[model samples]
Target chain A: MRASRPGMSRALVRRETIAGYLFLLPSLFFFLVFVIYPMFMCIYTSFFDSNMGKDAVDMFIGLGNYKELFQDKIFLGALKNTAIIVLVSVPTVCAFSLWVSSAIYNMKPVFTSAFRCIFYLPVVTGSVAVTVVWKWMYNNYYGIFNYLGKSVGLIDSNINWLGDPKYALWCIILILFTTSVGQPIVLYVSALGNVDQTLVEAAEVDGATKTQVFWKIKWAQIMPTTLYILIITTINSFQCFALIQLLTSGGPSHSTDTVMYYIYYTAFKLYRYGYGNAMGVVLMVIIAILSAIQYKLGQTDS
Target chain B: MTTKKSALYKIIAFVLVLILALLFTFPLYWILTGSFKTQKEINSTSPAWWPSEWTMKNYENLMGKMKAPLWEVSVPFSQYFTEDGTATVVSAGPQVPGAIRWMLNTIWMAVAAMLLTCLTSALAGYALAKKRFIGRTLIFTLIVCAMALPKQVILIPLIREMSSLKLYNTISAVIYPIVGWPFGVFLIKQFAEGIPGEIIEAARIDGAGEVKTFTTVAYPMIKPGVGALAIFTFINSWNDYFMQLIMLSSTKNLTISLGIAKMQAENSTDYGLIMAGAAFAAVPIITVFLIFQKYFTKGITMGAVKG
Candidate 1:
């Protein structure tokens, strides 16, 4: 009887293994063919001098495209712009969403969810719609910003919000900020709820002020959430493509060019497939490194 | 004194959040009102906070831009290599408004993506979460790493892959990539972990087959996760503009957002027409989101717990 039980259990394990793989087959098929293949092609094609012309041929000039990427002034400027975007937006998005979530998460449930819904409106509105509306709002002659500014005596003249090299990138960043906060706010609210209530009350009774509690106990508890938010927001900002594409098209003298936009411009517009893929590879490395660091920090915390 | 001060601070925070919410929603508010505003009002230096005269001219202009059939009936996935000059065809259907056609295309794409993502993710996530199998940790780790990487990084190659598969310029090109994304699976796995193994063991001991047990036992338990994934995938794939822009070009195939973008590009400063297009694209999705807001929120939160 004991031998039969052991053999039968082993057969069950085998059955589980078979069923597990069968369940995984469909998802794995799509993942392998679509994601894994392209990821490989992205790296492989980066080494060749490829173009979109039917008559042309791909020439393997290993490291050549990578070499040109560093020297390309427009690309370097775009890198700077992308860097600026990541630096400015990640911290601000994390801070802003955290602040809004903290403020409303403790409110009446109706009011809390209402506010959450409202803040998420822009994201739900979709980028093309939101971008066009913002484009109108930033119009030099008829913009609400200029009108409101003049009415409030904040400025003497209508500033070309999307036209000027100075303000173009900032305007794109502003739109990105509005759309990006929705997910983080959603995430933060849940994270706040998940924080242990008893620990928070203990801190309060032990004479920790609200600010101290937020900075110490609550903050420590939500570090993983914060880290997760940080990495996601970082990825989001790095891929700021739509707003730039619609609003400025990398704008007045390429001042608003992000690496993502530049990649689109190069590969699709200019037909420099190899060069664009090289840029893609670089971007992937940079993001992977940043995420790795954040992930490791998150790992060490626990 | 402390209580009073804290109450004042609470009030201040409430007011700030309210104001910020308004500011954030202002663009959508503008799109809604601008679509109904007069041309003169749209161009006026002093912007109209409210439309002075409401009219349907924008929608009229938008609808009149290009004429396509109101709806078309065709075989799903009938695309194949035709020897007769690309004549591998599906049966065609009636004439439709170009705008409504775009809406249909967008709806079809989003729904297909949602259904596929939920089905595939549920099965895979259940296996990963419940069934002890070799390479489970490795696969999960790979999914997490891939999810961290932005989807756009592989754009160049995806275009090539889609073209090679004869899916370029078709809805399938857009749908497959979104389905292929592993975030949905990761999310479902998180939710699926809550399923008790004892139930599955009991079902198996009760003589239920594997497929039968899964369909009857695992599926119902994971329905909420699937719901969240459905809503999330729908909203996201609806707004997946970049992929659509590259993949689908024919007027009839353009998603509503792409159609709006095309109209805006052609008539850059024609705010009224553009707003009408914007309104068409934004309002429906927003309505869907509002209706399923809880599922959407659950979709966002489910993946990040203690991560």
Candidate 2:
């Protein structure tokens, strides 16, 4: 960010540089110590046999943990579950939020904000609280789902939604969907409001149908937001842990084990720090590659 | 934009949004109502849409479960300054229910994080946006990239770092990382860029020192961004269960969310008591969010417009 001007002076540049670094010093300190340093350590420790003990000597076993990760059945299962969550959740969340935001963005001001706040309530309520309430709702014998199902003849008997492997992952996905949509909905509504009004009117006057106007005109305009929503939703779906931990603990034969949950289970519970760090590295690389692909797609489309 | 829509289409869309809104609000509604339901109603096969008896029994049980001193006053890095190389932790308040203590701790943590994030980010974001320093481009690039990466990947290493610094099992571990997160810096930088370069120049020509210029001319202008960042950080800090979960393991140090999780673990089938903890944790944060929601929305929206 250098300036080139007829009257620009070396002393002014020096003073500005000093001031800039001084201002950045505090934030840079915290960022380096907490974020950057830990990041390096996460990569560095993945090569070692750093078991749970704090004082234990970490033997360097380069690629050993990564090799073991491929052979571990539970780790592979977790990877599958993590992929399924990302694949299912990201698109659904994006489409559903886009639909909801389009439906309400043009409404009266009060109604628009009211709708937005209502959709975001679950998010504001905090995850732990929301997870607990849903646990009760999905209770096997006395859950509201079963009670209503029986009354309406949707099912003949009680179903253990969380305990049964068949429905457990789906149940976790449903809750994740609810919490995930809030931010995307907020983002989309704002983006929709910013859409070019005259362009929309021109398209309508040119006999363009509503769907054509949306897909061809409005969608391109909001593509950055769409990309943002997609990336964020994907990341969130991959890191889905609190819900699994609280409701199922990845139970019913590891049916709900996400990579994030598995990381916790391995490092903290199984005392395999090196293995956990290996999983963390793989997850990070996957996210980075996906985010890069998304960036490129968003670039080409927009 | 609202022109020439079919009446049926409009009607259907309206009805659908209404239904979805109701569905979305259900969990919070259930949390409130279920907290008041009697144990008999809760255990019944038929779901009670509303409570037959709105009782305070659940709250009583939640409060009775654990007790701790209401406040603990300790310096953050005071250990290095002390005689025995241990921080002086002095508890001065009367014993209160652990739920109440957790709530207080959560509020204190959120407020502290919010203040620190705002101050540090305002200074750094202003510099990045307005100053042409050496390494400015490098620092800005680092921040934008870091903002995209998942934070949990580094938790393993962060745990060790905190332990070595003697800040493990303390609230500062949670607060420092949150303060370090670059989202606020990125956001405030976006806001600060909108400030005209000439205004800063005018202040500089008037012989205002860098700090003086920022405090007087720059700070007031970017106050709204800081306000948004404050509310955003507060709500996030309050709900950040993972960091709180790992850093603060002791019973007395748990945040409200952790308190609820612990309660649920202990009383797995006790719906009434669990609901009480849920209500206690959810209601205050929800209330704060509703009040400052306009700013919070702005924060999220501004944060998305990245470098």
Candidate 3:
């Protein structure tokens, strides 16, 4: 492009740009096929009365699926179940992680690293493996929990934790809660690391109690991380499926169903593509609204 | 001045954390010992905290079964026929060989997906951060929005499309969707934003092409972020269960996570065997993170630097 003559130099520049586009092509292709295209297809298919068995889509039935979703008892139950799980699990994990993070932060460096690795071990553990281990632990007979309960005199006899509807949701929630503590803890630790040491030292010099120093200084500094963890955890709980599907399959009368699990069954097992798409659209909306609120809240905290 | 009081508080905090840390570590400890104990030992009247008899029988049996050729042997127990005409088979437990195959499949898929995600994210992130190109803000915004879109919402259509393209039940089905991931791109973009523009301009002025400048000057600067993205992507891919289960239906095609789920559905009460499989499966990921714990921690902190 250094040539004063425009034609050949312009062609060379155009060729370079084309090469840049080529470098971008593979990434763009996958994103379009997998993410963007699928999203639009999901929205578009929600308008049609389609089932998976048939190759061709049925007649367009705009808003029918959405209308039916309102009346679908299972769908409603799933939404309620998801809400309960998110409400219960996210705060529990966040609080627990924050507590542990502060604890780790206060520890000596070598011990802190050791404790961090131990805590983060679960996050690195494959979900299936953890679920299986937990499932075995939750067994009525030959299970560690029941065995422990009997040994501790907590119960006279074994209780089927996974089979009982009343306790099944709790089982799944506890598994999720325990396994997810690592992420928020990591975030909190990083957040705690960034707290201004001088401010904390000044507070200490001012004769403020440790609790006051933590509450007034360290906690406020970690607000942004807290907000991030809250939003991500909420999103995660709403979409919690793999463990539930493997452990319960929304079982003992759908007491443990989350909205994401419902959508999975609807599309894959029930073959109700249209209905599944509708539920997905609703989920997307909820996630978007919640996440946007969190973003705003995060900015304000910053 | 108040060192004594602070020391007391520190002691309390230490004790509190030590308790929580042990609680956090209990599951892993259980699995570790449970794996070493025999089925009878595991199911005793009073469960042993440590294995009374640390036998290699389970591992030997599992490894022997896994070494079977063709990777599938008709679920072994049923096929172990008596010398007589009668087939005296009872339970068809999980094929250890099959589980090993599945784990390998998961590892390969995760590795491929991790490489693709890191490469694409780094380049795209570099472009977004360093380039003053047209539509830059729009691309960055799109990636941020993508980070918020749950995979569940997009999974159905993605699967349908995969089946149509004949990618179902293959590793490609799991790996392709994760390539060029927007979340990692967003993460890397944030990290790359800290790269001083002068470095790139200086390299370019010194006769380096744009690609040269990116690889030589820009890439090394964002090494920590790239490392973070790789660890994150690998962990996420390794632990992913939904996509693996939905995409790969056959036992032979299962991942470690899916294999564990299958074991759960089938075995139900074999705590020793289940724990054995779990410990074996989880060890690889944990070992990887531990070996690279420093990098993993640094990478994680860098990724969360913005959030």
Candidate 4:
């Protein structure tokens, strides 16, 4: 009986090994073929001077794409635009959503959910649909913004929101702000709900002011959610592609040229696959660094 | 005094939220109403808050512009079909409105992606959570790292890869990449971890085989996670315009978002027609979203908490 018991346990372990591998097979097939292979090729192809069509052979031009990217004026401008967007959108999205969540999370469940759905509508509306509508709304000749501005006496003359470089990036940022807030608000609401109410009541009983209670207790408790919101918003802002592509097409002298849009333009339009992949690599590195920095800051804050 | 001051602050906050809500709802509202507005009404400097004369002209123009087959089904290893006792070689079917075709394609793609992602992720997640398998931690770490990487960074290579696989210009190309994304796996794993090991051991003691134990015990426990992942995948795949734009080129295969994008590009100044297209794309997805909002919210929270 004792001898058979050891053998039986060994058999069971072997069966588990087989079963575990069987469960992982389907997902691993896709992950390997689509995700892992592409990721490898993205870095590998960046070293060559590659282009489209079968006749063209990729020439090894070690660091040539990266070298050219630094000197390319358009690429530099795109990088600047990307930084501006990430800088502007991340804080505003975090603050606005935090405020909105704090205000509404305490409301009745019906009202809270209704407001949540309304804000998320723009996101669920899909980027293409949202961009098309915004294109109409920013029309120079007949848009509600111009009409409203003229009526309210905010401006002396009608302004072209998207056609001018001065307002174009900001216009993209505004639409981005609307879409970015929904997820943060949802997260913030839940985080706020999870805060220790007993401690909050204790603080209140001890004559702590509202701001004091918020800044001292609730804020620290929700630091992790805030950090997550910051990282995601930064990433989303950095990758603001569909809006720029559909609304501006990186036009008006490339004022709205983000790294994402430029990458698309280079690969698809100009067929500079290697150069585009290099830009993509740089973008990934930047996002990784920023996320790490935010994580460090979050850890210190708590 | 504090009570009165708080009451006033609450009222002010309520008003602000109400106004913000209106602003947020305006674009979708505009899409719906503008779809019904005539060109003259659309171009008027004094925009109509609500349409005075609602018409279907925009939708009519949109439908008339493009035509495709209502449906096309391929039979494996068969070239001909019998209609009225005569062998007829298969060809493209009769023409239908392009918008309808786009809608159909979008729905089919989203549903396929959702089903595939849920199935694969659930099995993988159950293993990662419950099975004491070698390299489980390594696999989980790889998935997390990949999730952090922005998807667009890999698009150029993915395009080349898909072309090499002869999957370009096909909906499957779009669907496969989305399934390959590991967020669903991560999410389902989080939920699967909550399943008690005692129950699973009990099932094993009862002589249930591996697959049988999973189907009977693990699956029932992870059904909510699967539901969350399904709705999340469906909504995300439906809205994934960038991938659809890159992968699909043929008019008949265009998803609704891509169709609207092309329409807007061609008719840059035709707000009415664009709005009609946008409305068509937005309404169905929004309806799906409204119905499954609970599951979607749960998915987001669950993913974030574990993330």
Candidate 5:
């Protein structure tokens, strides 16, 4: 009986393993077809120069695409633009998101719940309609903002909002910052919920003020979420494209031309699939490196 | 003394929160009011802070303009023109039929994509979460890695592939890529972990098959998760413009975003009509959010908490 029992258990384990693989088949298949194959194809196609013209032959160019990218001023401009947005926006947004989240965490349930909903509405409402409305409101000559500013004596006259090369990128940055409350807010709130109530009460008993409690106890407890928000915000800031296209299509002089946008423009508009793929490879490397560094930092911090 | 200090802090916090709240709320208020105002009123040098006459003219004009499309099947083509030699652009009323058709197309595509995503994610997530097998960790790692690869990197190859398959300019082309999302499976798997193993085990011991247990116990436990996933998947598919724009070349297959964009670009100066279309496009999503706010919160909270 004991020998039979051991054999039966092994059979059951084998059956379970088979069943698990069976369940995983569909996802694995799709991933292979849709993700893995395409990724390989992207790399493969990058070596051959492509033109939209039917008569042209695809010339095999070894590292020629990469070499051309070094000299491509448009590609370099996009790289610079992406870096500027990420460097300027991520830190400020992360700080504000954390602070606002903490403040809301302290408020009463009714008030805080309403605030959460209002803030998250933007995530669902990032439509061209909203963008258009904002564009109208940011109008240089007749904008509500300019009108209000003049009424309050903050400016002498209409400040061209989306027209100027300098202001165009900044305008996009401001809009993006405002619309991106969903992830950071949700992270802070969830992290706040997991905080040990006992520790908080003990700190209170020791007469720790709210600020001190937040900085000393709550912040430290929520470090993982903070780190997560920082990494995601950094990754996201690097991928800004839609609003740039809508509000200003890489602007008066391609000042707002982000790397991803440049890739899209290059591949679709310019019909240089090989060159675009080379840029894609570079972008992937940058993202991978940044993610690795963030992971290391997170491991150390923890 | 402590009471007085606490009171002071409370006052400061209240003022700060109120200011922030007002700042956020003001733009929405401005837009809502702007929607009500006439173009002349909206463009006036000293714009009216509030509509003095309070005409429903904007809504009326939008609705009247929007009607020509629905009636196009009944109305003769020549009836669209006026008696004068001049072309009456307003008589035809700006292709409202096309806009309605695009809205339907968008909704249908989103529904199909969401259904496909849910089926695959649920099964895959359940397997990953509950079953112990070799290569499970590797699969999890791959999914995470896939999340890091932005859609831009893949669009070129995907477009090329779609064109080769003759699926370019079709709704299926837009939705097929979205159905295979790694994020959906990751999210569903995370939620599935919260389900106790005992229930599944009990069901199995009670002579219920694996598929049966999945249908009954596992499905009920993950119903909230399914709801959350549906909303998110729908929204993502609906709002996605870049992929659809590249894949869809024909007007017949254009989704709402692409359609509206085309309209605006083609008729560059038709501000009123474009606003109307934008308003129409925004309604479905806003309604969905309001109705399913709790699910959205749950999905977002769960995803963020895990991250």
Candidate 6:
């Protein structure tokens, strides 16, 4: 643990390097084999026209998949749907969790944890389980939504919630919102707890209103947490696959098609490996850009 | 005057959150209740909020659909010893429901993932935190960047790689990718950084080797972080539907979540049967989350701090 002299010792450096790599070997093996290797292949395979099964050839078709991706209406539609999901879910998840956290963060510890667990139930309940139950609730014939809507005179007839394009995407969004709030709520609660209490007390002593104190003092302190929440929520919403695949299968005229679901459908169902890889590359780039922008904004605000 | 108004606002907020909590919990409530409803009750257009006729018919039907051996064990490299070079399989007892088999497979996958990830991440994280070695900064940066990438971005290539390794459609394929992810390594590194340098130096001064020092001193200090990572990985791998769906296709290899999804797809209109499947997939994992809620929360907050 001694500090290095002006002239370093080469043998000590060699010993440290060997020891470090020895410890890193097992984890590095898996990381290199699974993560780094696949990342290279994902980018490499995007230029070829590959398919599943042995007889199918991976023909070199430079820029062909990307060119088609731009012109394909279905791909464009899927992109737009993904955008809608990200836009709708990210802001609402942040705002809703912030509100819920502020309301419960100062309560009794038992009450606070209870509310947190309750909000997190849907997430803890696996997505396939949540989606199937929701599909039943949205059923055309026996759904509770239809029954309650008719009973309250909200609609004259039963609505085909998942079968109609108009309601299908919205239904998907509602389910996504439920599964999306758990971690953000947890983050916000801890962030709010870490806010400077003396500043809030000083503002209160000067007769600042509750709303004023929240915005002026607590808001600035939690901006970084908010930014983290925003990015994770955005990434999660963008990767909303299980719900769509389980509930709608991007059906009812492909109204609920998303980039993640489309990538799965193309790669597995249609066997268009190259095309799917191209979509994946685009999705990754978009997420990287969005996260960068959020990071930058969060820094400026703080 | 201000105190009274603030008190009123607080009351209103409490009421609103209570209502929202009820709404949030309603889906799970519906699932639990609906699983017990009779076919006649479930199909009623009027919708019974509470089941007038509770029955085990749905579960009975589910169990009757498919059956697997009660238990099976296959030894690694058994194929090489066989006359025909085929793997040897050992079975125990009578046949049980496929749901039981899926549950067993899921538990095994989650546990294996947890153990492997914890062991490897602890070793790597300790090294990254304590060792001043060449390329340490680059490796740490790579792990962080890889953690940020959405998992699906690697799915297509992963399938191909699995096939090349002759591991396609196996439980190990799914488990490996889950463990291979770098988030655990990063999380454990954050925890390891808290270990005082003097302790490590003392261990070395006492003639302890690197492995002994890590095992005796470092592991005890970071045990809580490892606990958090274990439960976190378990729940996530159990619920990782996209990976499970892509990597496993055979009925015998399927996880409970995939089993439920398949059932729902086939029996689209049979709400009673599907709810039974959903309940089966959800209950055990939710129980695990409740038991380890504290560690799980810590893992999440820690990840976010670096993220």
Q: What is the TM-score of chain A alone in each candidate?
A: 0.94, 0.96, 0.92, 0.95, 0.90, 0.97
Writing each residue's lDDT as its tens digit, candidate 3 over A135-182 gives 767877767788889888998998999999989999999888878877
Question: TM-score of the second chain in each model?
Answer: 0.92, 0.93, 0.85, 0.93, 0.78, 0.94
Alpha-carbon deviation at A10 in model 6, angstroms: 2.6
Residue A105, candidate 3: C-alpha displacement in angstroms? 0.8
Task: Give the candidate number with the greatest DockQ.
Answer: 2
**For model 1 chain B, the run of ten residues with the poorest summed lDDT:** B81-90
Indicate whether candidate 3 or candidate 6 has the larger lDDT. Answer: 6
lDDT for each residue of candidate 6 in B167-265, tens digit (9 for 90 to 100): 777789999988889988998898899999999989999999999999999999888788878877988999899999999987777899998888887
- TM-score (all chains, Cα) for each model: 0.95, 0.96, 0.89, 0.95, 0.88, 0.96
True contacts kept of each: 0.79, 0.75, 0.54, 0.72, 0.43, 0.78
Clashes of 2: 0
DockQ of 5: 0.42
Candidate 4 lDDT over B123-233, as tens digits, reads: 999988888756777788899888888998888999988876666877888999999999888888988999998999999999998899999999998898888788878
lDDT winner, 5 or 6? 6
Report the lDDT tens digits of candidate 2 across residue range B19-86: 99999999988899999999999999998899988899999999898898888777767876887655
- Which portions of model 1 miss their true places by more than 4 Å? A1-14, B73-79, B83-90, B133-138
lDDT of 4: 0.89
Q: DockQ values for all predictions?
A: 0.59, 0.73, 0.44, 0.55, 0.42, 0.67
Taking all chains together, the TM-score of candidate 1 against the true structure is 0.95
TM-score of chain A for candidate 4? 0.95
lDDT of 5 by residue, A114-135 (tens): 7777776666765565666677
Sliding window of 10 residues with minimal summed lDDT for model 2 chain B = B1-10
What is the lDDT, from 0 to 100, of the residue A286 in candidate 3?
91
Question: Which is better, 2 or 6, measured by DockQ?
Answer: 2
lDDT of 2 by residue, A1-302 (tens): 55423466888888888998999999998988999888888889999999768689899999999999999999999999999899999999999999999999988989988999998988889999999999999999768999999999999999999999889999999999999999999999999999999999999999998899999999999999999999889888888889998999999999889999999888889888888999999999999999999999999887
Best-to-worst order by DockQ is: 2, 6, 1, 4, 3, 5
